[model samples]
Target: MLQQKSKLAHFFKSASVIKILPIALLIIAIFNSYFIVNEGHVGVVKRFGEAKDQQNPGLHFKIPFIETVEMIEVRTRKNAEKMASSTKEQMPVTVEVSVNWTVNKEAALDLFKRYGGLTQFEQRILDPRFRSATKDTIPQFEAEQLIQDRASAIQGIEHRLAEEMEGFPVIVDNIQIENIILPQKYINSIEIKQTEKNLAAAEEHKLERQRLEALRAVNTADARAKGILKVAEAEAQSILLKGKAEAQAIEAKAKALKNNPLIVKLTEAQAWDGRLPMTMMGESVMPIMDIRNANESN
Candidate 1:
């Protein structure tokens, strides 16, 4: 009986370890089943290598061995790339591009099923498609047009990329053409051409100003000549009028003298001094005697 009791105690001790081991394993499995899905992320539940369900942020439970969860970020993402391409003029150019994108929430299952992950999706679809679209669109513009009309080129690229990326699980929110790099030779040539054009415009403006000045000087000189001519003509007319008046006055005086001969004697008497002339010969004295009598009578 003593030996049996000792064997029973040993058996109980062994059974106790076995029971505790299963409970500990069950606790571990329960802990592993429950997981926290963080904010900005969605949990994709896969069962037997197939997507079965999706879970939002917080605590979630699933079959331990048969089910697994993958957290996919559904936030906006940014990517930048530089591509080398040629223009219509066959000039080599470097185009830097920035893309803002996001994975569509409703399409997350399709995305996971199709590409397995964001990295694969970008590598297989987004990057190659973007580069191809840019290369295809760039050759439509010349180097000069590409530089001068950059907005148009950027819009074209964005539109083409959007078209190509259609039906994909990713949404391209915006595309930006950050920078364009032309060859050094082309840059130098463009600078020189611009400088020459500016110089030509300045020269043309200067010539126009000089022509206006010359026209103004000519007009001024013509006005001065006309004034001088007008003054000379007026002076000549005044001189002619004075000469005609003087001649008329002289003719009138001559007519008056002819009509009255006594006027000349009166003019001579007024001019003579109060004195008598002396006789020189005998005949002159006889004539002088009449003059002396006339004087005594006066």
Candidate 2:
């Protein structure tokens, strides 16, 4: 009977130890599975399907059975989508859109818990929402707008997507319309429209150039007029100086004439040089006489 009791005690002790063994192993496993959140990534923690907290880029720990941690990448991610839709004017068009986005690190836990976990968030919420939003927004814009005002359309869609994905805890940094695919008809039409616009712009530029040229001509004419006035003023000043010199010379000459009476006679005698003309009456000719010598003889 004592041997049976001893055997029963040994069995009970072994059973209790066995029961605790799995728990200890599980604790060891949890501690061993420590993860490091990489740069630009956040880790999400959950306790029995309930969100607990988010972990930044570093070492982190969690309980073995009562708590579990799932690392979710919150880094910037890029996605591309191509879509075909009808415009507001019922024009069929195709487009390719590229999106740059990142999961919000601060709302990692809330994102995992509230939105049916990470898988569901991507599959159910993000994909469908993106398709639907792109379809709705593209159809509201014209094909020409899709081609010409692409940046504006992209901005509008990005804003709307940011609002739609608000609760999903994803931030859309930029949404770019990479390519606008259209039928040949639409392409031809757009090309023609662009050509016409370019022609109009060219004409406007020509008119502007002509206007500038005309203004330049007017300025040149004004400058020429000023130059002519300056030249005329300089010539008038030179002529006045010449006139003054001539007047002074005439006054000096008159003063000399008043001071010397024989001056006129002397000038007359000087005017009669050796080239004296012979006097002729009919056929008879007389030799020229020297009036100064005759006057001296008289």
Candidate 3:
């Protein structure tokens, strides 16, 4: 133990240890003095609990342990608040309001100076203003109108909130009503009406389909009747043409017989069977003779 103590004394007695002790402390101090602001944040440097200046993103330096940096986000942020209010018709509605906001880098120090921090600023001033804006705007819209035209309701709220947030260190990028709770009775009635409307539409469509089918049937009947008439007319025309053809042939035959009466005698001689008929129709029939040869020979 005495040897270890002597070695420690000898180590502390060295000149290098004396030199490095101050350097090590200086290095630690320097490392702690510089602060890094992230890519999307701005640093609020405070000197003795008072706002001094704002620093943009990147490496920055400050007196060690004297100046402290608070990173205030300059990027856009979103938050929602649900509140109850009455409509223009005195109907109560619950609305969930959302606000998108960003800190102005230039006024971050001023914001820190005024509200001490961003959280305090939002909780104390912004929240009240938001509630006021909602109260003022919700009265302008009836409960039914709010349900039917939510865009208009949101616009009214945004406009009023924008006016309220004027001159603040933050810019109100946008405001939205995330959800609106309508009265249950109204919703039920709307659902019933929608159901009736759907049923009526279905009935109308069915009637339209049936009307089309009836028209189609009528057209089919008409087409079929026209087709039958056409076939009948074609048949009648064929019969008439056949009758005319037969009459022409008969006329030719009659003209030939008139020009040559011996053709009739030749026809009768050719038709004779060489057997006498047992009976006659109205009078006695004569036996047919070959007159052509007889006439020619004479």
* Candidate 1 local lDDT, 226-293, one digit each (tens): 99999999999989999999999999988888899998788889998977666545644354344666
Clashes of each: 0, 0, 0
| Model 3 alpha-carbon miss at residue 60, Å | 1.1
| Candidate 2 per-residue lDDT over residues 32-54, each given as its tens digit | 56767788767777778777888
Q: Model 2: how far is 184 from its true place, Å?
A: 1.1
lDDT of each: 0.88, 0.81, 0.88
C-alpha RMSD of each candidate structure in angstroms: 12.3, 8.6, 9.5
Q: Which stretches of candidate 2 lie over 4 Å from their true place?
A: 1-33, 166-168, 199-218, 234-298
- Top candidate on TM-score is 2
User: So what's the TM-score on candidate 1?
Assistant: 0.60
lDDT of 1: 0.88
